[model samples]
Structure formats: C-alpha cells, structure tokens
Target: MSAPANAAVPQAEQSLRDTVLSRGYLRLLLLCVLLGVPIALACFFFVGLQHLLQHWVWESAPEALGYAGPPWWWPLPALVLAGLILAPIVTRVPGSGGHLPVNGLGGAPVGPKELPGTVLAALATLPLGVVLGPEAPLLAIGSGLALLAVRRSAAADAKARAVVATAGSTAAISTILGGPIAAAVLLIEGAGLGGARLVALLLPCLLASAAGALVFTGFGDWTGLETGALALGELPSAAGPDVGDFLWGLPVAALIAVLVTLGRELGRSTVGFTRRGSKAARTVACATAVGVCITAYALITGRSPAEAALSGQATLAELAADPHAWSVGALVALVACKGLAWAVSLGSLRGGPIFPAVLLGTATATAFSGLPGFGTAPALGLGIAAAASATTGLPLASAVLAALLLGGDAAEQMPLIVAASVVAFIVGQLVRRQRPEGATDTAGAAGAAR
Candidate 1:
C-alpha cells in the first residue's frame, strides 16, 4: 500500500505539470489575440500617416503650387530637409534611429525608449521620398510596442517577455507584406530559430498574425486605404518548368545575387566613408546623393519623379498591370536609379530594403523575358525570388514571398520560383564576403542586407 501511494504522488505531479503547461499555452494564445488588435490598429494609423504626408509633400503640395508634376529637381531640397530633421533623432536618440534595415530584418527587440527614434526616422525619410520600405520600421515598432505591453502586464520573466515581444512583431508585420505565413517565414529564417523552440515561437506568432490580419482587413475596408499588401495583380499564363526554364533561371538568379550583393556592399562602404563626419553632414550628403539618383532616373526615363520615389509599391503594381507599357530602357533606368537610391537609403535613411528590391526584380525579369524559352511568367517569378533572396539571405522566405506576390499565378510558377531562390541564395553566399565579427564596418551597420 505504501509503494502504491508513493507512485500515485509522481503521477499526480506529472499530471499537474502537464495541466500547467496546457493552461500556459492557452493564456499565451489569449495574450496574442489581445495584442493583435492594438498592433493592427497601430499599423493602420502608420500607413495612413505615411500616405497623408506623401500626398501633401510629394503630390498635393506640388499640385497646389500649379505644377503638373514635380520637376526633376523636386527631390533635392526635399531630401535635404528630411536629412536635417532625421539626423539629430537618429544620432542622439536611443536605437540609432532603429537598426538599418540593410543590415538585416528583425534583430533584437526595440525598447520603448528607442521606439520614438525609429518612428521619427521612418516618418522623416519615407514620406520625403526615400527609396525604402515600411517593413523594417514597422518591425521595430511592433517589437517595441510589444515589449512595452509586456512591461505593463504580469509577465515579469525573461522567457514570457521575449515570447510576447515576438508575438507583437508578428502581429504588426502580418498583413503588411502579404499575410501571416510570410511573416512566419521572415521571423523564422531571420532569427535562425528551429525545432521545439521554433514551434513555440511560431504558435504565438501565428495566433497573433491571424488576429492582426483580420483587423487589418476590417480596418482597411473601413478606412478605404490600400493596406499596402503585395499583389502582382495579374501575371501572364505560366508554362510548367522545363529544363530550358531552369537554365535561364540559373543565370538570372546569379545576376540578381551579384546585383544585390554589389548594391549592399556599396551601401555598407558608406558607413565608414562618412563615419568621421557630423551626423547632419553625413545625412545631408547621403540624402543629396539619393536625390541625384532619382533625378537621373527621371531624366533617363522621361517619367515623373514620383515614379521613382516612395517604396516602389505603386511602381511594381504598374509593371504587373502593363508590362508592355514599360520599355526595356525604362526598366533599366528604374533598376539603376533605384539601386543607387537603395544604397543611399541603406546608408542614411530609416526604412526597409524589401520594396525596392521587389521592384528591381520585377523590372529585371520582365526585361529579360525575351530570351528564348524564358517565358514571361517564369522569368518574372524567378527574378522576384532571386532578387528577394539576394537582399534577404533567406531563400525560403524570399521564394514564398515571390510566389505569393504572383497571386493567382503562383500555382503554375512555384517550381521556378523555388529554383531561383535556391540558386540565388547559394550564389549570394559565395559572392558576399562575411563581415568580421564585432567590426563596425558598413556591413555591420547594414545588419544582413535583408
């Protein structure tokens, strides 16, 4: 009887442990859901703010002054002004105006103290026509906000706080690029998390993401503003992948890897190139260089300066909507100018590298579609994937993003996109020189490229 009673105690303890874990997970799920609403709301507001400023500064104000479009020189003073405003914030504020997105996508969590600097930097650069995306800034914002939330809540343990912070990031990024799955891929690959730890992180992320996406959808409908989701709109009918398609995709991916690596390396060099200068001087000089790049694109393509501005989201939609309308010359100009702008932005501005890369990828792929046996759809898909991989170093995530962006066309194009992603990622690794650990050279300033 004594032995049986002792065994019962062990079973009881085990049962209690299992019950506690189950309850803990459930509570976490609830926390994620609750957090999702506010993060989504915050994202909605941020998007609106960016749009409002872009319209008044880049479009409405120019129109109010009676110009049909901003002249080629329009961005010069605009960028200078942005640099002036952002210099102090990035240099003096906590978080260095947020980690440069070119360095990598989600790194350490942004503290509440650093959140303001991140927001200020993005607001200063993005609406003023810096060729960067909102993704990185939003990631920081989400992480910061989540950390703040956890600080205010009952979660005092280190593990709980980290989980909540990650959940916040996932919720914030869920709908911005495409959906929860994309967010999952980005966080998983970018963080290098796997196995049981990956599963734990992923559940809260998925839960928060689902809730956040729902909120974004509902709020977007209510507000009637585009929620900044990537949609390829329409794609040409894709033929199944053939040997010839892979052959072309291989070269295309290689080219993309080189272009991305070269651009990032150039951007990284700027950190040291301007390190000795005052923050204001560096910011002004870099912004001016970006303005020059945009002007060159306008002059070369004979398009409005606005076409080369922003994060390149609208331009990507335009390319997908009417590929025939964009001459090869125009596409080349866009890629060249945007690459230059991307480098400058990476060096000085506060934004993500994602949108510009996507646009460049689309243009490059479309331009090369005339190659024998490289159909339009496969080339376009491969280009987008390779370019994304080049920038991000996360081939799997990049492939998913590219395929999903193709919208209805993904079913037929997934194989080609996957192949391109793998090839580009491997080639990018070969072409990219690893940064020495703890060195504050340009590459460290950038993060990982994506």
Candidate 2:
C-alpha cells in the first residue's frame, strides 16, 4: 500500500503552491527583486575594476616600457608579485581565499566575514595573470553581501538565508554569463534541483536574475563600462550537423573529457603538494610555476604571455573570430602550456575553473578542424560544449552555455552541441570513476585546503 510515484506529484505541487502563497515567500520574492539590482551593480563594478587593473598591468605598463605587449619575462615579475600578495590572504584570510576551484563550485554560501579575503585574493591574483576566472569570487561576494542584509535574529534561519544567498548569487553571476538564463540553468543543473524544493527555490532565483539582468543592461549603457562578460562576438558561419559531424564529434568530445579530467588530476596533485610544506611558500611556488608555464608558451610561440597567463576569455574570443590565426602546432602548444598553468591554479589559486577549460577545449577542437568531416565551426562548438560539460559535470547547462557562446549560429549547431555535451559528461564521469582508489582525491584534498 505504498503511495504511487505519480501520487506524490500532486502533493508536491500543492506544497509548492502553498509555499509560494505564504507571506514569507512573498516577502522573499520582494527581497530578491530588490536585492538583485544592487548585487548586479556590485558585480558590475567588481568585474569592471578587475578588467581595468588587468589592462593596466598587461597593456599600459608594458606600453609605457615601450613594448608592443608584455615581454616574455613580464609574467615572471607580475606573477611573483601576485603570489606575494595572495599568499598572505590565503593563509590568514577567513575564507582561505574562497573554495579551491577544483571543488567545482559547490560549497556552503560565504558569509560577510569572508568577503574581504575573497575579493582581495581575486583582485590581487587574477589581474596578475593567475589563469583563473572571477566567477567563484563573484559568487562568494554575492552570497556574503546578501547574508549581510539579514538581521541577526533572522540569521539563525539557515534555510531562508540559503535561499536569499542563492538568489543573490544568481543575480551576481547573471551579470557575467551575459544574462540570467544560462546562469539559472547552470545553478539548477549544478545544484540538482527537483520536486517541491525545486519549485520553491526557482521562483526567487528567477526573480533575482531577471531583475539583475535588467539593471546590468541599463547600467552598462549609462556608464559605458565594459563588464568583460564571457561572450563571443564574430563567429565563423556554421550549418546544421551532417552525419559526418556527429560521427566525428563523439570521439572528439570523449577526448576532450579525458584531457579535462587529466587537468583536474593535476589539480589534485597540486593540492597534495601544497598541503605538505609551509602553505605560504608552497602557494608562491605554485604561482611561480604557473608563471613559468606562461613564459614557456610565450617563448616557444613568440606570442604574448598574456595568451597563456590569465583566464582564457580574450584568447577564446580571438580564436572564435579567426581560427586561422593559430597554426595547429601553436594551438597544441597553447593547450599544453595554458593547460598546465590552469591545472596548478585550480588547486592553489582562487578563481573559477570553467573559463580556462572551455578555452582548452576550443583550442583542442580547432586543431582537429582539418579532419575529414569536421568543419571549423562544428569543431568550435563541439569543443566548447564538451569542455564545459566535462569541467562542470553539468551537461544540460553546458549545452545551453555553449549555445549562448556560439550565438545565432548555434541554432543550426544545437544538435551537435548537445551530443558533444552529453558525450563529454559521460566520459568525464567514467574517467573520474576509473581513477585508482589511491589517487589523490581532488575534491576532498582541495576542499581541505579551502
């Protein structure tokens, strides 16, 4: 006489409806709407400042020194300075510079006390070319700022605080993901929302994101400040997937998954290494090693070290706009150098992992564009989807993210993108599961460092 699964649906629906109608939820909805604007504004300023500082360090300073761009040795000093600044924050700061990127963006919401450390760590390192993204720090900042709005008495209600924090996070993250839809899908898939709880949380998040998007749109127009969001502008034309594209995309996606998994393994090893010695010294050593990797890429390819040093947003855009700019051999070197820097940064630095992984995927896929059936556009889309799915372990979100990045051409390439995402997701899971039991536990070890 157990209740049927179908029977639970109505009860869940009724509970969701009741919850939505409740006064507390109504208040929360209002709070989310109100909070979204400010949260997005804060994120806007944060991202804007980070970009400005980055431009100064990499562009202005080098130009002042009469170089076309940063010299090959430029990253060494910049990264050393970054390490010196970041070491103290990671060791002494309350949040340990926020969670290590190897943990894949799942953790408790940050509180106000940890906000300074998180922001300082990102500003200090990311602008100095740490090969990490700003998403995690933005997430931490949003959640912390939101929690700060709660009354001391209300703080005891963990559930309400979490919801508000999530809403704030969605709003802040929405600014960077171009808009709320991809951000919402990302959080939904990453958090595994379902059932009544899903319905309950979805409303607040959606409201916050929508409101935040509106504010960001208006503010950018008014202030004329660049948000430096992750988006591609001029992509090469693409057509619908033919049988050949699908056939070739499968193994390509799997290969990307394997490559990304290897990067994560390297991150685990870094976590283990950082744990053994004086944490501060070890962190600086990892940072300097990342600098060496960037220097190696610049020396070998005769390109700017910036290409291999920071989060790969600009390089990705450049690659999408003109894949021909990079020779296959150069792309391979970019992959090798940037991939190692990214892997080390993942366990020792404070930033998001998804951006560089997407770049890595794109580089790898673009190298294979000359394959029998693979066109450059299809290769680009497949690489983006596969890398994103593998790195984040959220196939549906990765598909949406890839489609968003691919822009109008994505409509034609959706099928290929979806297939690649699914393939990469499955392959990534298999790779992780296949790791030996004695292997360094990337998530656990990285989490401990945090």
Candidate 3:
C-alpha cells in the first residue's frame, strides 16, 4: 500500500509540474502580445515624427527660421534646446531618463516608471542632428510604456510583467533591425539566455515583434511614406567565395576591430567627462564643436553637410550604389570626421551608436574597394559586419544584419561577413581584456587634467 501510494504521488507531482509550466508559458505569451502593442505604437510614433521632422527640416524650417537653405547650424540650436529640456527631466525623473539610449544597448532591463522623461529627452535630441539614432529610445520607450501599462492593470502577475516588458522592448525595434528575428537574436545573444527558458521568452517576443511590424507597416501606408524592413535595391549576383577573398577580409577586419576598440574607449571617456561637467556647458560645447567640424568637412569636400553629420544612412546608400560618385580621399575624410563626431556624440547625447558605426565602416570599405580582387559590394558587406560586431560586441547579429542588408547577395557575402565578424570579435575581446588595472583612475586623471 505504501509503495503504491508513493508511486501515485510521483505521478501526481509530475502532472502538476507540467500543468504549471504549460499555464505559465501560455500566460507569458498573452502578456507578451499585450505588452508589444504599446511598444509598437511608440516606435510608430517616433518613426512618424522623424519623417515629419525630416520634411520640416528640408522644406519648412528654412523658411520658418529665415535661413537661405537647410541651415548648417540648424541642428545646434535645436540640440541646445533639447539639452535644456532633457536636463531637468532626467534629474528629477526616475531611471536617469532611460539610461541614455546611447549607452543602453547591452544594459539591463528598466521599468515602466521611467518612460516619460526618457521618451521626451530622446525625442528632443534625436531629430536635432545629434549623432545618434532612434533605436535605443524606441526600445526604452516601448518597454517602459509596456511596463507602465502592466502596472496599471491588476491582472498581471510578477512573471507576466517581466515577460511583457522583455517582449515589448524586443518588439519595439524589431522591424527597424531589418526584422524581428535580428532583434530577438540580439536580446538572446546579448543576454546569454538559452534552453526552455529562452524558448518561453522567445515565443512572446516573436509574437510581439510580428505585431509591431504590422503596426509599422499600417502606419507607413497611411502616411504615404516608407517604414519597416529596409529595402535593398538591385543586389548584385553573388559568386562563390575564393581563397583570395578570405585572405583580403582578414586584414580589413583586423583594422576595423582596432578602430572600434579605440572608438569604444574614447566614447567611454567622453561620456564620463560630460557626466561630470555642467550639463549646459557640455551640451553647448559639444554641439558647437561638432557643428564646426561637420561644416568644415562639407565645405572641404563639396558634399552635402548631411554627409558630415547624423548617421549617414543616405551617404552609405549612395556610396554602396555608386562608389565612384565620391573621391576616395573624401570617403576617408568622411570616415575620420564621422568617427570623431560619433565618439563625441556618444559622450553628450542620447542615441544608438550602431548606425554611425555601420556608416563609417561602409564608407571605409567603399573607399578601399578600388583595390584589386576586392569587389565594392562584398567589401562593404564584410566591413559592415566586422565593424558592427566589434563595436556592439554582437557577432552573430552583425553577421545577420550584413547578410540581410545584402539581400539576394547574402549567400556569397555571408561567409566573408562571418569570417570578418569572428576576427573582429577576437580583436575586440583581446583589447577589452588588456585594459590597465587602474584604467578608471587614469581616465579620471586625464579628465581632470583636461
């Protein structure tokens, strides 16, 4: 009787465990969908706002502000205004205005309580020609809003709230990142999560991302503009990889890795310095200096000032389509100017670093493609992966983004991108490991001395 009873108990426990797991997963999935709605809405709002701002900057702002053309100094005053607005909000608000989106890529989860200030600050800085992208703010806003919604509701459990927050954040930029898969992969790889837990987390994330994409598409259609999943035009046919291609990739990857390491350190130092300085001073000084540098570059190169500022997506696209349009020297200069601008931007602004880094890499690769045996398109793809992976410390996502951006040409370029990513990853890791024991002290000393 005792043996029989024990056997029944084990069976009953197993059934109960299965029941709980199933119920938990189901609830999480539902919560993820619910959380995803607000994030999608926020992303839609920001993207729409950006489009409106672009139109205003190009057409209305010049006339409205009494400028002869898109005033090169236009972004500066706006940036200063943004800084003033953001400073007080961040100081008084929770979550430090969503952890400065520029610095939040590999950061931990933040709650909904911090949404208002972060979203406001990001909107102020992002469209003002600050060298940052909307990706980080989108994530913060999406997740924060979702968390807030969940908190207001009485039905959400602790586990359900966590799942929703994660899903909302992941879905916010899902389409912006080419697709939801890339965003999902980024979260998974960056967080080092796996197994059944990962699957449970992913189901909701994927669902939310799908929903976000749908929302973005609907809004874009309504606005008569483009949004969601960047379209690659006229992809060149991919050829099989050769030994020479692989060999050429190694050195280029190594060079980009080194540049990324330098940029990362510079960004860290700049951010620290700015954080310690008076907010207004840092905002004005950085904006003025960057503005001057960009103006000089544009004047010197006889190119649009846009080339010297922002994330350079347009420049990158043009270069990729026709490398010969710009002189190699000009491209090289663009790389240097943009890199420095991005470093400074990271220090004093709130935005993502990925776009600028990709732009820099693409420009460099396009310039170097004049060499024998290296095709422009392939080199651009490889450099994109290498530089992105090195800077963001996400090799897999880099490889996928490069490949996806290449579209049909991904097959041939995929291997090269992967190889470059691996090398960059190793170089970046080694550089990170080799930092001096008193690096923080040294950095502080340098800042103080400055």
Ranking by TM-score: 2, 1, 3
lDDT of 2 by residue, 291-340 (tens): 99999999999999999988899999999999999999889999999999
Task: Provide the global lDDT of candidate 1 against the true structure.
Answer: 0.77
- Model 3 residue runs over 4 Å out of place are 1-21, 63-82, 101-104, 152-159, 194-236, 433-450
Put down candidate 1 lDDT per residue, 78-105, tens digits, no spaces: 8888778878887788888887766756
The lDDT for every candidate, in the order shown, is 0.77, 0.83, 0.67
Worst 10 residues of 2 by lDDT: 441-450
Q: Residue 223's C-alpha lDDT in candidate 2?
A: 100
Q: TM-score: which is higher, 2 or 3?
A: 2
Clash-forming residue pairs, model 1: 102-446, 103-446, 103-447, 103-448, 104-447, 104-448
CA shift of 130, model 2, Å = 0.5
Q: What are the runs in model 2 whose C-alpha is more than 4 Å off?
A: 1-9, 151-156, 194-237, 433-450
Candidate 2 matches the true fold with a TM-score of 0.86
Clashes of each: 6, 0, 0
- TM-score, predicted candidate 3 vs. hidden true structure: 0.78
